[model samples]
Target: MVVAACAAALLAGLTGTAHAVDNLPPDQPLVEDLQSGGKPCATGDDTVYVPTPPRLSAVLYDPEEDNQPSESSPLSGEFEAWWTDADGTVQRRDYSTITLSSGSRQYWTMPSDLPADTVISWHVRANDGHATSPWSDDGNGSVCSFVYDDTNPEQPTISSPEYPTPDEVFWVDGVGVYGHFTVDSPSDDVVSYTYGFLGGPYGTVTAERPGAAVTIPYLPLTSGPKNLTVRAIDRSGRSSSQAQYDFNVKSGRAPVARWKLDDPAGSRSAAAETGTPARAGIGATFGGPAPTGTASTTTVALDGSGHGFLTPDTSATDIRDTFAVSAWVRPAETGRTMTVASQDAVGQPGFTLGLHAQESGALWSFAIGGARLSGGAPETGEWAHLLGLYDAETGKAHLYVNGHEVGDAVAATPAEAAGAFQIGRARGTTGYRDRWHGDVSDVQVHDRVVVPTEVSEHAWRKPTLLGHWSLSSATDGASPEQSGGTPLHLAGGASVYRASDDSCIPDIDPDCTYVPPPLVGDGHLALDGESGYASAEGPVVDTGDSFTIGVVVRLADSAPAHPMTVLSQAGEHTDAFKVRYDPPTNSWQLVMPERDEAGAPERVVSQITGADGGEGPGQRLVVVYDDGTDTIKLFLDGYTNADATASLPDGWHSSGALQIGRGTVGDGWGEYLHGDVDEVQAYAGALRDEDVLGLGGETNPCLC
Candidate 1:
């Protein structure tokens, strides 16, 4: 009988009519509805913004184990879930008694009584009649997690020292008033504030922590009544009620005519911040970097090619006695006299304020007809603040470079050469001589001679130096700061050596390549690849605000196995910012973390491939965070890399020591540099392109 049954089964299998039994267990359950709007409700970091009374859902999976059609078609199963509430109380729910079908979804609504700001961690598993599947997780062994926050942050309070109250008028001294606004919030969860002037687009300012006051710089475009509104935002992306602030801005002593030169490109006219506008002739181009503040976006570029000049209206020509002319200028060439601002006279200029080429170098000068007073060597292709003052009462013409007087005032009689007020060229025995060959911005003409204090104020727009290390020498295991009190202490056999000679005159030498050359200074600090670095007891720079950091580095290994940091500042869990060479991408990187916490996402901007001259020789690296533009710019060898620039509208403060030659990795220190480091500098404000160029050219940025 057994042999006959076996023969019958073999015949059935041969005929393709054998019965097959399903005996496999179900696959792991895939939770459904865990995401809202295509974004996962549970996140790896922080809470996800969601509606109240969150619902948990999942899709059950089962492998049919029975041969019967009815039992396998709609496979019955049960799901089990466990969760831990914010208060650390663990709870569970079992849907074993309730019937469920495979490949179908089920949901469990969270209790309405769950407290606000409650964080819930949960996991789910599926079980068939015979077997159970593994529990679902976030792939890293941790249970899925999310926060239940529905409360909004409290309203923010706004105040300003320049404009205290809405009911009163605040008198400002200049056309560009940098009004300082302080914003504070009562809620501890507030992380940032949104603010803007009435009828204007809003801007965001991130706070260092909860309840910490944030100071925002505002430049009023016009002088009149102004209204500003601010709203606090919490970590969960909830905004509070708005707070309104009102104030009036009035110029105390307005200029007779002030040409800001911020007009659109190709426009024939440059708008005046105070009075009549100036007309741009053929060769003048727009959109050059402004000399100072964010209020002035661009300056006019004069190539010294052909009839390039800016002529103001007749209002500026009325300055005959006790007049002052001041403008920020960056000279492209300095071998000959270049007139920045001048008024036409019969045979000569009424007054000329610009660079006068001397045997020693180009000197800042103020000249009247036959007399000229010149002092202080002004570098070519670098911005300089020039002011010419003619005080008729004193019968002297004063010249100032930067904010200080240069040479002794020269006695010169007044000349009534009230013709046309011209910028970029002056009239001499020859027609239109000494035309300017560079950028000009913020031209102002005052009817009365401005005092020394006012001249100082006009010339003082350079960034404040937080710390500067020339790295020329190391004494007693420390590198002394050139401009500040903080010093960097050397460690792990780091030592100083004379820097290599680089004979490249910027914008002059034909052989000079655009790539930054080797270190030009006296000496530089050398480090071993294994363990060598320098550190300071500081958060030397306020990373949360607009600031600049720069260094000249030459890597020992062109293709290192890992990233090599040139400079960094440690935060609580990571480096707030790092200027480093990353090997994987073979590029120089400017790295900043999205948050200060550990495992946070990083914002990396990179440029200049390692094989393309980023290694071997010393290269100038500069990073700038401009809060006004909401941008982080990376500069390689005095040249900006457009691809390596990004919009970082918010910043988190890093309150730790400034480190050189090493960066933070996880909970320990790593990314040590194997190279030479020199001319490390930190500034409290964003520096202009000309300023950065001056640094790379070995010019003192302070101009002291």
Candidate 2:
């Protein structure tokens, strides 16, 4: 009876406690909206495309947490997501978390398993463990939607009325050719196009909308085979396959007179390949070495004796407005005025293309009446191509040497001249003076000012390739020459091996280091300091004339005990020229003996100091002996080393075999290099500064 009474009292106490406790549920969580990629989700029929996986997010609120006074008020603990596809397929995802603040943001990234190019509707709801909020909507009881799209846009369609056909060649009417291109995308998603000429920089053009056609204007500076590539880009930053457009451009204008000067010995007249014939003066002698380096053609030699000149028909004197004159001349003398071609005026010639004597030195000059424009210093005994132009529209006189413009153009009007066109001499106040004292070939006169592109073409007609040793592929210790010259035989431990990395290709590779075309073939040649060397037949190059020699080299030892020789031409008693590294000064040196005979007291050495002479990446080292200017220049990586340049008035011929990896000391070979070498090129004529830079950069000197 006592136990039953105690249970009844306990039951009455529990019943009173339950009535005193609060039993109200937390206010419903407030669902705001859903977002994708930090942006509000697309509503209605609109769908947003994404490049990568879509990241969805939402801002949530809890009314119960907002009403509470304490900062630690209970908040939503988890979220539920519902996604419906176009086919009514429903998918759910639950995300659990610790109690959040009253108002906080939450995010969820879509899974990679989501199908691409498909539209899907998605919504989010808040849950606080006790109760759940309604799903988010676009305020109209509709879920937000988007489309996953990772596909690239379709290829662009390119067309140009100026260059209609890809296989046909188009002629340039003036200085340059312009093509109006219309680019269109087959896919409606494309919004822009990226276009560029092959081997050039790319540019972009935007369209008004998807599938809209865009027009672009393109102008090519030089005439040649052209290839334009266009790619369509969509809003998702996806690029389509490139569409290539191929065409060719050629110069339309031709020279009025073209004198090849290939007349045989004892010929009294020189026939013009395009215009009238010219009569050779008393001292004009034919049958000299031609710039083409071919036996079929010859140059006219001049003695500078008053009578060494050529007079063309009176029709050549008809010069008033724009005109141009060009010729390949090898002057034998300097320090005085020497004319290559001129037309007589009153006190002075109307226009004279020749060397002008100045207090500083004799410089390449183009004169229109009294207005004289001097270019770089002229090198005697070296073949150089000179072009003088008078542009009436700009009222300027321009001069170019070796396919490159000299100094700035001078403003001048053409002087009136009616006398016969004279070659090798210009008329002064007294009489015919300033006679040329050398050889001249390939004289051309244009009725109109030739464009820079065409001028370069005429100037660099063809580089005489004396020898080219690629050192790429070797068999039986012999490396074949590329220019049909003698093969190089390896001695000691010299070997050909492939390069470890791909050489720099302009517009493709990030690095701008220039690798000669030959080196891009198979491999480079390696040499051991002790005895490894390569040798070819005697007289690979005529050292006495203006010539260019270059090689891509890298040292194996940063600081060696002795100097290292990369290239040299051996003479009977000593080396005619040597491109080597001097460790004592940490410099690259261009060494030439004062005399070919032994025991020469002095050595002409041009050294480039403070350069990378260590075991670093390969560099292009070129030595140009410009006999016309009597200068020897050293270039490293396509840049001139001004401090290492000097005047070398003359050089003696070296008849001994060309030596690689070693140079001649006293009467024997020494200073052997321990490094890798490739792309050994020797040209009969000196290359211009641009050519040297091109050899070390992306531009092809020969092609330019």
Candidate 3:
């Protein structure tokens, strides 16, 4: 019966054997399970019925895989192994042993001498002693050798220099690849830096940089095919491996040729080392021309009739209020339509940049107060860097090229011009056309907006000329030593000057030269019957300390009825500080200087009369005194703010000449001041509130 089913499947695999019946040494034979007539089975018919086969047991040394021990690394690692009894027979007896170090198997060195958390074992003694084999249950075995760690070495993963495909030529290479890296921890601890491959062109590096590792530079691009990656970092900044690839680039060139040859004596030593200096205003009037129709000059030459250009005076003031215009162009013939700066008239809305032409030609254009902006297409002869900004609140307008932002325009309110403002031509009234052909040097006029792009790149990178003064009559002969010919550059450091009247000319002592004495409107009050002598004209002073007062009136023809006074006497007379003009409420009064009962001031008024209906004679009266503040203001042509009086008072008494057109001394019917008074100034302080709201002038003025 198939040998009783092979002895009933070999006694059912000896179910968990457990023996120790007798001492049976020298006996090892048990290879059953071959029937057909091999004996030990044949008692039953073709059926299967055979059992009995459980003898030999008793070998208790269940060392259970050599008493566990391993979980500490760093010093060259690697030591994993396991075994329960895949066929029994493991021996090494007496506390066993199994070290290893000759030529070191994997990689190690630590506290030497087999140290470094070392441990080894493999004990087993199944039948090497007497005899215990009757299903022997007294044999033993165990195995365990130590070295638990895993060595450190992973920080090398870079990919490529790709991206610039379209037949490649050149425009933007890899001027700034990625960066970072380092490795050595397992025992030599020290590794960090990770990032896989962020997004195609290149990205995805984690761990950030612990011990280090992050580089990415193979840049050779021009504009095309690109894709590079990297990874592999540890030491806490943990990161595995991932390196990618794909790249190509090439496009863009032809901007580095430079030229301007054909020396006409080397262009006259480069035009005498870039010459440009000649500004006049001190009594101006140099020879013919300059009065026919009033104002026109353009010169900053390189040859083309010098004086680059100038037109200013669009009916007097309306380039959008509080105006300013500056110039200094240099480009003899670059790219064409050159009008350095314009004001394009017709009905108003003022502003216009350089180079502009229709028929689909010429690039750079800017217009405000005339509307027209569109930048980003410039470079025609080189020497570039421009600025044209206008801001009435945020009506916003800009067109800066070298300093970035190349175009912008928005108006809820902007564009309100009134003609005349051409620097190279565009002013109307039937004359001068967009004439700017080229060569213009250093121009500037800021009633506002000059935002530092390093001061417009040091205003076109230095050609040098730090100091200049004009108001000419030919001091070009040098040495008049006049400080107020417009030479007050004490910005905020304080120490201004302009005590004019010829300042100090020829014989006011100190080596002959002291003319100061021409302010003759009312020459300090007291002019009753007029003979031009009010007991030697009393008060009319202002030696120094914040001031600005210009006059040129004509409202007399028949005075007296209390119609004149321009005081500034600060000692008694009620601390005098007047600003008069009140022919019975035709309006305008601010007198307050009375205290003469031995106390001083003999007059006081403070603020009343206010009705401006127009009073005649070249009419222009200005008053600005901030003696750091005590309150006393009034302006009309400078822009009118009307009404003021804050208890007005400030230590005063220099008793000098600042009291024009009448109001002091003998008070003689307030004579001489009936009208006609030219350009007079007393600026020492108080003058910048945007030059008292007229919106300009402050190229450095001081009052402390």
| TM-scores of the models, in the order given | 0.36, 0.53, 0.23
TM-score-based ranking, best first? 2, 1, 3
Candidate 2 on 430-537: residue-level lDDT in tens?
A: 889999999999888886667777766666544466777778778888998875668999999798876545555757876676443333455788888889999987
For each predicted model, how many residue pairs clash, with residues at least 3 apart or on different chains? 1, 3, 117
lDDT by residue (tens digit), candidate 1, 520-582: 577888888678999998798788767888888888765678888888998888888998888
Model 2 lDDT, full chain set: 0.75
Q: Which residue window of length 10 is worst by lDDT in model 3?
A: 48-57
TM-score leader: 2
lDDT (10s digit) by residue, model 3, range 283-314: 11122111111122322333323333443343
Better of 1 and 3 by lDDT: 1
CA lDDT of each candidate? 0.74, 0.75, 0.36
Which order, best to worst by lDDT? 2, 1, 3
TM-score of 2: 0.53
Please list all clashing residue pairs in model 1, or write none if there are none. 22-65
Best by lDDT: 2
Flag regions of model 1 displaced more than 4 Å.
1-252, 292-294, 313-320, 462-681, 684-704
Rate residue 276 of model 1 by lDDT. Answer: 64
> How accurate locally is residue 459 in candidate 1, as Cα lDDT from 0 to 100?
67
